[model samples]
Target: MNSGMDPHSEISRNLRAVYQEVESEEIPAHFLDLLEQLDAAERSQSKKDTE
Candidate 1:
């Protein structure tokens, strides 16, 4: 724990590593479905705007 590095930089580096680990995991099926629904809604809105 005492590598002579500043504590703030060490903490930030650790937090970023943890976040990258989480970001690499697969997203849940439910969340993917919700994202698809949002995309569909945006397309629908675009079509309405064009009309």
Candidate 2:
């Protein structure tokens, strides 16, 4: 919600910030899979709520 950041871009930025903090060897494939699922669920829930 900063001056130049749109919601989509802001989400991307936040994801990059989190990714940077994680160790490469410690990263799990399921983490990315779950992130995507969670993101989708959030979007779906928001859409449902708005309606």
Q: Pick the candidate with the highest TM-score.
A: 1
Clashing pairs in 2: none
Model 1 lDDT tens row, 13-39: 898789999998899899999999999
lDDT of 1 at 1: 70
Model 2 steric clash total: 0
Clashes of each: 0, 0
Off by over 4 Å in 2: 1-22
Each model's C-alpha lDDT?
Answer: 0.90, 0.83
Worst 10 residues of 1 by lDDT: 1-10
The TM-scores, one per candidate, come to: 0.52, 0.49
For candidate 2, report its TM-score.
0.49
In candidate 2 the C-alpha lDDT for residue 18 amounts to 84
lDDT for 26 in candidate 2 is 73
